[model samples]
Target chain A: MHVIESGNVAAANGVKLARAHVVAAYPITPQTPLTEKLSEFVDAGEMDAEYIPVESEHSALSVCIAASSAGSRPFTATSANGLLYMSEQLHWAAGARLPIVMCVVNRGIGAPWTVWNDQQDAFSQRDAGWVQLFACDHQQIIDTVIQAYAIAETVSIPVMVCYDGYILSHTYMPFEIPDSDTVDGFLPAFSPEYALNPAKPCNLNTVTLPDIRPDVRGDTAPGYMEIRHNLHTDMREALNVIKTVDEKFYSIFGRGGHCFIEPYNCEDAEYIAVCIGSLSYQLRDVVDALRQDRIKIGVCGLRVYRPFPDEAIRETFKSAKGIIVLEKALSYGYEGALYADIKAALYDCDNRPFIHNYILGLGGREIKTQQLLDALRQSCTIDIPVPQWIGLKM
Target chain B: MREDIIQIRWHGRGGQGAITAAKIVASAAFSSGFAGVVMTPTFGTERRGAPVLTSLKISKHKINDLSPITEPDMVVVFDHLLLKEVDVTNGLKEGGIIMINSPRPAADYSYKGMNVFTSDINSVASSVGLPPGIINTGVIGLFAKATGLLDLEPLLQAINIEFEGRNPEKNIEAARLAYENTMIGESR
Candidate 1:
């Protein structure tokens, strides 16, 4: 049924349709509404999941990790400080190879305290070995959440579906809620090979020495280093899994499948604006306006961050003369993290475009359509400087 | 002619349901054949009695812009008291529509370059036996009447969907009363 709803509500419906066995989270701004909706679903008996309200985000993720390790599909959500608080458990969940799905409503990190939209919160957790997927709108939020579960379970790795807080979370849009039977057809039940069962009694994650050890049967087994290596291998496999799951979803529902990075009007273009989240929705207008003036410029919204869609990045911008990366997070003294990744991806190209990074809209700064056009006009002149902060104070 | 995309800003207190009004208005616009409708609120910890601002953007196609509406085509003030506290007229487009929940005649209020419309939403709310404090939905009716951007039945439907309880009938009646009573003010 098509109903007008907020992104948080769409996300909660995604969890309900997926029939997540364990829903655990700490109530935080933006993200609080998502979990609250889930709690309502559980209370109304609309969903048959155990909704665990934990004391802190740390406990929230730990609950998910425990539930998933015990053979149940678990889900959790947080933003900014809450995600930071659970950083330790973030690594543990991936290390345990638990197929847990988490929604990180991206918010600006605090010192001055802002509860607005930004990608920094989720970007900070890039090294945690979890697949990061960013959605551009509320519909993508719903579609991605369902796909995240399938991808996570397939690779035995956790996935974090991140969308801009308040911008997407609080915004209302009309989206079709996929029926549970259709969702089940796309995503089957979880059946783990190994679990925390006393009848089968096996010590999971026992202390392994640095050196490779031989088993009781005299077979050489993987060491701690090998375990980490396997995690890396799985991360690589997730690239394919992400695409496959998105394709499966598109087949079921008429909407998804262009999963990794969404390229808009990039073909036959000389310049491209690289960005993520709802801001990209606005940039499309800038691109269209510029196109009317006959400036061949386009935009590519980076959807999946972790198993960084390097190939897609290269393929999309290979024809462009200049690639401008618009990011909401800064790496302190260095360029934006996305800028570094894009540059690295295109390093081997013989005719690499001048990749420039512009850190804009940090701390929820409003990015006007004219400002974007002005930046694009300035970028047209070669030798554009890196880390050009949009609407920055002196 | 109507714009390809319509931008509206809401001025109200924290407890006045400006966010709720924005969402319902966006939903109403979507149901009225605008394929894209986005409603957003000012992000922060909202407290009752504090100033709150919300925005709604409606387009015929998919809306690409996510920024707050800086230059609004229309502005709705849920509480007339907000006029003194905030510059409710700031960044309003030329000949923009301004709807306020005031008992005074629209002719009595004048902005330098805009059309001001007035309706006594509080009176309508009370006439419909709604609680004394809740006048947000009533103001929305005034908005629909003043702008004519959305159809009356869809706006009423959106309100009913939002308030899916025993009092939907009353809320719909209150909206109808406010719609019938809205008055157009002079643009100086």
Candidate 2:
């Protein structure tokens, strides 16, 4: 049914429709409403799930970890500081190969302190071995969460569906909630290959040697390095799984083309703007504005940030004249994290453009479309400064 | 800035339900055949009586931008005092309408040459057994009558859906009364 509600409610409904068996979360700004709505659903007997209200974000993911180990579809969510608290478990969940789904409402990590939106929180955990998905709007937020469970379960890797905090989280927009029965048909039951059972009494992820080692049964098993290698290989394979799941979801729901890199007017354009989350949609207006001024520009929103869609990135920029990447988070002293990653992805491409980076909207700073237009206009001229901080004040 | 979209800015204190009003208006616009309607409320922490604003965009086309609306085509004021506390008039179009809630007639007020329509929305709320400051729903009538942008039936349906079983009759009646009572102003 078509409904007008906040993005948080859309996410909560997606979790409900996916029939998540367990939900564990700690209340954090922006993300708090999502968890609160889940609790309401469980309290109102709408969704049959064990809502475990944990004390901290760390414990929240820990609960999901423990629950998923027993072969339950567990879900959780967090924001900046809360996400930072879950840093250790992020790797643990990914390394353990658990089919856990999480929503990281993107926000800036605290130095002095901020409770607003940014990509820093999620990007900081990019190397944690989990698949990351970014949503541009409320509809994508709901659809991606449903698809996330499918992707995570299929590949046995955790997934983080990231979107801008406050921007999408609080805004009310039109979204269609898919029928529960259809969603059930689309997403299968959660059945892990290996699960911890009390009756069986088996140990998982025990200490491993440097190389191939023998277990108590005298059978050879992959060692620590080998296990790490398998995780990396599965992640690479996950790119295919992501594509399959996207296709499957579209066939079932009729509302998804946002694959690894969802391109907007990029097929025919020369200069393309690349970013993640809602910024991509925001830049679309800029693309239209630029087009009127006779600038051939477009946008490529990186839907899957991790497993880094290197092939798609390279293909999109194969013939483009320049790439203007505007990001919310910076890699501290270096440059924009995604900008650097995009450059790294395009390094091997023989035909490439002068890619430039603009850092904007850190700590909830207001970003105007005019500012973006000016940036894109200058970047079309192809400036030399790598990471120009927009809206800087002494 | 787009010619096709109608941008609306709402001014009210934190507790006056400006956010919910914007949402209901967006829903009403959608029901009134607007293909794309987006509402963005003030994003951070809000305290009671502290000024807050929310903006809604109604368009026949898709709204892909999430940028702030610096200049609005219309402004809805839940409390007249908010005009003093906030710059509600800044960047408002000269020919735009300012649907405001006040006891005085619309002719008594002039807001930077923009059309002003006044309503005693607080009294409308009180007459309907709603608390005095709960004038958000009552001002919707001022919106409908002053702008003539939306049909009253869709708005009433939106209110019914939004306030289902929570005194829907009273809210509907309050909206009807305000619509009948709204006075259009000649810009000063």
Candidate 3:
């Protein structure tokens, strides 16, 4: 069904359709509406989910961890400082291999308390084992939520569907919401391999020991090598499962494109710009206009961030003369996180295009289409600059 | 044939339904067989009474321009205060139209090189027993009178579609008052 709704409402509907059993979230700017809408759905009997209004972001994730361990499809959402507050639990969730799905309304962390669009929150958690997917538009926002459930449950890893804070969260758009039955047919019911059951009484979250060292802490425990290997393998296997679930999703929804990466007008383009979140929409128009003028320009939107699609990245930029990386987050000392990843992925490929990193739209600064076009033009002309900031006043 | 689309930029505060008004206008235009897109560059920290700019592009052809309009063929100011805070007149094409929801007459405001139409949309709304914030619908009616780009019948039909099954009568009455009270002509 087509509904004119806000991104938050769309996400809430997606979570409901995905049949999440438990949703625990603390109210934060931008992220509040999502939980609030879910609460309404719960109260109206529209969704059969337990709406847990937690005390804080930390407690929110803690409750989600507990719920997921109890064999329920658990979901939660937070942003900026909220994500920071739940940082410890994030590691716990990932290490425990809990199939928790979260909607992160990306916002800037604050000393000044800015509640605007930025990737600082999600990007800061890049090392966490959760599979991260950034959505470019409202439709993607809804679709990714459903896809996240399948991907996370398939690999027993948490997944985050990240979108710009105010850009997509608060903005209203026309979105297609699949009926509940249709969603159920697409995304099966959650059935975990292992869960916390008192009857079985299995050990969970035990201490680990160092390799080749005895009595390191006090007692011998699980090997650290084994734990690390397990986590790595779970994450690695998640990449292929994400692709498989996305293929199934495409078949059900009848929308065909790479769910992990959306390539726009890139088949024969000379210059390509890579971006995620709302900026991709702006880049799409710029590429279209440039293509009309016979300027071989294209765009690639990286939807999947965690377990980054390295092979796809290399192939996407293989033919381009130059690639511009548009990021909404900064790493301070080094280049943008995505830029570093792309550079590392293409290090072995011959004739690799100069990858210019453009940091933009931080603290919710507006990024116009002209600015994106200007950045693309600059990338085509000069050597890809290091740590270039776009739309910055100084 | 090139579609003669009328792009409008709406300036209002949050909770004022500025975005909803744009959607209703677009939906109305769509119901009239014209293609349109409604969008807003929302902020994560948007609050009540905060300045928000929403836009609507109505044309017979597909609109692929996602960029915010630097210059608009029509400007609709839902709040009087936004006029001072935002440059609603910037990039306003020649012979463009400006619709302001103010009780004061059009002659009171001085804006050269553009046609300004003024209406007491709030009073009209209150008279119809609707809230003051429904001035966006009034502004849309003024848009219809100023440009004739949309017919009132389709506009009302679109409004019914939006408010239908929920407050349909009041919305239709609000649209009618707005269509009647709008003062349309060239700016002084």
Candidate 4:
């Protein structure tokens, strides 16, 4: 159905269409509406799911872990502090290889206490063993959530679909929603290889000793090291699953999107801007305006951040004269997380561009167009400064 | 108005439906075949009677800018009292349009440097039996009639969808009353 809605509502629709059996969440500012709508769906008998209104974010994911382990499709959502609170369980969920899907409405972390948009909360958890997909708009939010379930269930991994808080969450846009039947045809029911059952009792997360032990089949069981190694290997394999699911979704829905990075008008451009999440929309405007003046500027939006689309980044920036990476989250005492990844991607490239990283719009600060324009113009010079802080009060 | 993009900023109190008005207008524009339509209500803590802001950008082509509308082609004030508390004309384009929900004549509320249009949205809402504090569609009708940015039919359609179950007829009636009763004026 074609309807005008907010990103939060679209996310709820995605969860409903997926027919998830368990939704466990603790309401945060921007994440509140998504869960509220889900609760409404459950109450209205539109979806047959148990909406667990947990008291804390930790319990939210904990409940999801229990539900997912019991051979049920589970979903949850949180942002900023709530995400941080659930960090311990995040590792547990990933380690257990649960195909749990979460929506992390990206918001500024509290120290100064802000409830607005930023990517730091999710970026800070880049090593949490969950696949992270940042959405550009409401439509992408809905589409990515559906794709996330497919990718997660197939790869035995968790997926977090993120979009900037309030910016995409509160803002209204027209999104084409897929019917439940279409979605069901695209995403099948979750059937796990290993689920906790009383009939065939199995110990999960058993303590591992220094040496490998023999299994009942006379084969050596995976140790703690091997388990970690397998997790890494599965993550690497997940990159392929992500792309294949996106292709299948496009074939069915006719709206194809880049699984990793989306490059806009970068084929014949000298200067390119790199950003993530909803901020990419603003950079596209700057690119278009500069293009009108024949500045040959382009933008590349990082869609998937966890697997870190290294090859795509290298390919997109191979011929560029300069690259400006604008990120909302920083690595404290270093540069932006995205900049670090980009630098690593092009470290061995033959034609590496003069890269500059600018951390902007932290803690919900406004990133104006004029500031970005000036930064881009300054980046064109020969002697460019790295890690230029845009719109700093100091 | 710029043919490529039309930016509008709305000034109103927290409970006056300024945000809803902006959304309805954008929905109307989108329903009228404008593929690029965005409506953003200012984020953060909001309380009733407190001043708030929202913005809308409508384009025939794709709109890439996610930034707030710093410079607006049209400025809409949901409550006349907001003009006293906030600079309702801030960043308004030269010869741009400023609309207010005032009962006075358009000429009476005209500012020094922009065209002004006035409509008694409150009266229209009251007459149509809409409860107090819901004048979004009424002012939207006045906007559609004054600027012709969106067609009246689409505006009504949007209103119908916005207030689908809660007496949509009253809201549509309020909108029609505002559309016919609105007074438009030239630049002062």
Candidate 5:
């Protein structure tokens, strides 16, 4: 059924369709509405899920971890500081290789404090071993959440379905809600190979020694090295899983075959602008304007941010004359995190495009279309230079 | 006449339901005929009565521009007091419109080159027996009548959805009352 609602509401509906076993989250701006909708669904008996109202983001994810470990398909969401508070648990969730799905409503992290939109929150957590997928619109917000669950369970890695906080979360738009029966057909029940067997009583994630260790049965158990190695191996394998799940979703629902990257007019473009989350959608209008101005430019919104989709990125931009890497998160003394990754991704290309990076929209700064136009126009005309800041007062 | 995307900027205090009003219009426009409607509340400080703004963009096709609407087709002022504090029509397009909520008639307020419409929404709120704090719904009626951008039935329907349990009839009545009272003023 199609309805006009907030992106948060769309995400909540996605969770409802996914049939999350446990819903735990703390209230935060932009993300608050999403949490409230889940609680409403639970309270009204619409969704048969354990609605755990946690005290903090840490407890929220902790509840999800416990639920996921207990063989439940658990879910949680937060933004900025809340996500930061769950930093340790993030590693625990990923390192343990639990199939937990989280919605990281992207927001600016606080030093001075902001409740607005940015990709910094999720971008800063890039190395946490979670499969991060970004959404550009309300449709993608719901679709990605459902797809996240499928991807997470397939490979047993936590998934963060990231969308810009206020930009997508609070805005109201039209999106079709996939029917429950078809959704069930698309995603099977949570049948994990490993779970906390309460009756058998074995501690999961016990302290592993540096080298190979043995259990009470005198069998060689995977030590710390093998554990990390397995996780690393599975994460790389998840790229294909991401593709298969997206195909399954499309087969059932008839939309969203764009799994790794969503490309717009990039098939034969000279300059391709790249970014994550909703900024990439906003850049589309700018690309349209540039097309009118007789410039062959397109936009590539990198949906899967980790396991880093390097091969896909390389193939998409190899034939382009220039590549503009526009991002919201800066590595603080270096360039944009995505800029560095895309730059590294191009090294394997036989004829690499001249890549440029523009760091913009940190802490909810406005990135107007005109600014995007000028930036891409410069990247198309001017030589590659150091990372520049868009809309900088100085 | 610009017929592609009708972008409207809403100006009101933080707690006065400016964003809520924008969302209602977006909902109404979507159900009425338009294929795309997006309501974005400018995210920032939300202390009550502090100036807050939001924008509603409705298009015949999908809207890809998520940037704040700098060049709006119309500006809806939920509080006339905001007019004195800020230039409510800063980047309004040529031949754009303005709708204001005040006790004064439509002629009392005017902006250069823009058709101004004003209605006594506070009085409409009282006469319609709306809550003391519920003036935003009344302003929607004025917005609908002045702009003719949306139909009355869907506007009231959207209000019914927004105020579903909290006396939706009162809001519907307020919208109807203000819609009857609104009129376009001469633009100089």
Candidate 6:
């Protein structure tokens, strides 16, 4: 049924529908409402889950790790400093192959204390080995949460569904809520391959010996190298599983699978703007306007962040004359992370557009569509500048 | 007429339903078979009690510009204090209308070439025992009475749909009171 709701409430509903057995979270601005709604659900007996109120984000992820190790479907959410605090545990969740799903409300990491939208929080954790998906709107936020759980459980890996902090988190929109019966039919209870119990005691997360070989070990024990290789192979196979699960979700829910990249008006275009998060909605207006004026412009919204979705991105930009990358996160000494990834992905293609990285909306700065169009127009005139700032007062 | 769009700029604080009012107005125009777009141009960080600016565009065709409106055909100020902090009438078009929710006499305010409309929407809202945030609904009624760009019936319908029968009568009463109290066509 269609209902007007906030992004936080929709996300909480997604958690309930996914049938998460354990939810561990720490309160943070823009992310507090999500946890609050979930807490309400737990109190009202709507969700039969263990809601762990941990002291800190670090302990929150630790609790989720323990719960998921016991073969329970675990979930958690944090933002900015909270996510930074849980950085070490993020790797643990991924390396343990424990199918944990987390919602990272993308916020600016502060020295100035800003509780606003930015992708820096999640971008800083890019190398943590967890699948990351960026949602563009509230509906995508809800749908991606459901899909994250399915993908994580299927691959036995953790996944993070990221949305802009205050942009989508606080904005109210009309969204469709799938019935519980439909969600149950789509994401059935998770059945894990291993579980911790007193009856069958086994050491988990043990130290590895360099000289150990798989053949020398018994049938029950796998060598450290074999385990690492298995994890790598599982991640490689997860790409296909991600696509399949999204397809299945769409089959059930009637909305999913715009691929890892959604291409708008790219069929015939000379210049394109690549973006993520809520800014894409604004870009749509610019693209439509430019197209009417006979300016060949297009837009590409990147959904999947980890595993990077390189193949789809390269194909999407093959026909463009120039590419403008709008990023909400800045890499200290380096250019925007998404721009760097896209450049690396399309380095070998002939006649590749001059890729420009524009860092805008950092520390909660507002980004209007006209600024995006201005950047695109500038890209056509001069060589696309590196780390250009949009909407800056200077 | 080139059928050009009439862009409206709304100024209000967070939690005052300014964004909601813009959306409802746009939805009402769209429901009446006109094209419209509503957007919030937010900056820095927004918290409750902080000022916010939201814009709405009603066009005969699709809205093409997504930029902040520097000059607006109409300006709706939800708070009287905003006039001192920011120039609410800065880019108001000639003969444009400025609707403010203030108890002071409309003649007391100065507008060089624009028409000024004033109402005590908060008073009307309080009289109906409605929350102050519902002042937007009253402003929408004033907007309808002054501009005639949107039909009051469709706006009330949109409000009913949005509230889902919760406090609809109070909102309708507020709208009717605002419509009755608003004085338009006064040049200052």
Q: lDDT of each structure?
A: 0.88, 0.89, 0.82, 0.89, 0.90, 0.82
Docking level for model 4: medium
Extract clashing residue pairs from model 1.
Answer: A281-B64, A282-B64
Please give the distance, in angstroms, between residue A206's alpha carbon in candidate 3 and its true position after superposition.
1.4
CAPRI-style class, candidate 1:
medium
Q: Model 6, which residues run further than 4 Å from truth?
A: A211-217, A223-225, B1-9, B13-73, B90-97, B104-115, B130-137, B143-172
Candidate 5 lDDT, tens digit per residue, A13-45?
999999998999999987999999999999999
Question: Model 5 clash pairs?
Answer: none
Stretches of model 1 off by over 4 angstroms after superposition? A216-218, B1-3
- Candidate with top TM-score is 2
Q: What is every candidate's C-alpha DockQ against the true complex, given to 2 decimals?
A: 0.62, 0.75, 0.34, 0.58, 0.58, 0.22
lDDT of 2 by residue, A1-394 (tens): 9899988999999999999999999999879999999999999999999999889999999999999999999999999999999999999999899999999998888886888888889999999999999999899999999999999999999999998998899888899999999999999888888788888898788887798978878999999898899999999999999999999999889988668888888878889999988989888888988999989999988999889989988988989989988899989889999999999999898887889998999988888878888899898875668888777776
Ranking by lDDT: 5, 2, 4, 1, 6, 3
Better structure of 1 and 2 per DockQ: 2
* Candidate 4 structure quality by residue, lDDT tens digits, A183-283: 99999998888788999987888788766799767999988888888999999899889889999999999986688888888889998999998888778
Candidate 2, residue A344: Cα displacement in angstroms equals 1.4
Better of 3 and 5 by DockQ: 5
Candidate 5 residue runs with Cα over 4 Å from true position: B1-3
How large is the C-alpha RMSD of every model relative to the true structure? 1.6, 1.2, 3.5, 1.5, 1.7, 3.8
lDDT of 3 by residue, B1-188 (tens): 11355678888888888887888777766667664354555443568988888766667754444445676898888877788888888888887888888888777777887888878888878887876566667766776776677788887877787777967677777777777877765565
lDDT of 6 at B37: 47
- Candidates' TM-scores? 0.97, 0.98, 0.91, 0.97, 0.97, 0.87
Candidate 3: pairs in clash: none
Cα error of candidate 4 at position A55, Å: 0.8
Model 4, span B1-188: residue lDDT tens: 13588999988888888888888888889878899988888866779989999989888876766668889999888888888889988889888899899988888875777989999999999999999878988998889887888789888988899888989999999999999999987677
